[model samples]
Target: DAMVIQNPRYQVTQFGKPVTLSCSQTLNHNVMYWYQQKSSQAPKLLFHYYDKDFNNEADTPDNFQSRRPNTSFCFLDIRSPGLGDTAMYLCATSRRTSGGASETQYFGPGTRLLVL
Candidate 1:
């Protein structure tokens, strides 16, 4: 199946500690992205890689970082997870097709992090 995968649908961590979340895709897409959704807010793009080219959303916080070691995998590293870091982290992928302004992105179930 050409889909995104996220492990540990739920995660628990203490405040001020570091946490690592992951995502993988079987779609053979060239772009992979990480987004953070806090409560009912929109999924804000944290960063992404365009076939080894890393692009960070301007508004994304400094505490968030991502790495795509290869085509099939990527990792998100939270250097110091604060209380506000607790939220649903999503991994997404999309093929840069010729869709007009609405190329759909496929998402994984997400990893829910709870900071205590």
Candidate 2:
């Protein structure tokens, strides 16, 4: 069973329009991540927040921003969505542990954005 959930499974927006995607998790994970995946391309890590410490990928565009108001909720804001921004926005959650071993991430269904 997936603990992560993303709202607005499908969305359509106009070019240059601002849009927001929401994600929430049932499990109280310490870390959350946002990824953008274009068709036939690998998902790119936009950013991740670990217990209020936000970390953005160096290559992530400035148009993308994220907020984690609380432990269970996170929001992705696209200031000016473009045609190229049309892609699947994925939300994932994981627990950060002291061990070096990799932790498994629980992913949401993802919100598909279509910019016209």
Best candidate according to lDDT = 2
Q: lDDT of each structure?
A: 0.89, 0.94
Give the per-residue lDDT of model 2 (tens digit) for 1-116.
53899998999999998999999999888899999999999989999998899999999999999999999999999999999999999999998887733378889999999999
Error of 1 at 93 (Å): 0.3
Q: What's model 1's TM-score?
A: 0.91
lDDT of 2 at 92: 95
lDDT of 1 by residue, 11-43 (tens): 999998889998999988778889999999999
Every model's TM-score: 0.91, 0.94
RMSD of each: 2.1, 1.4
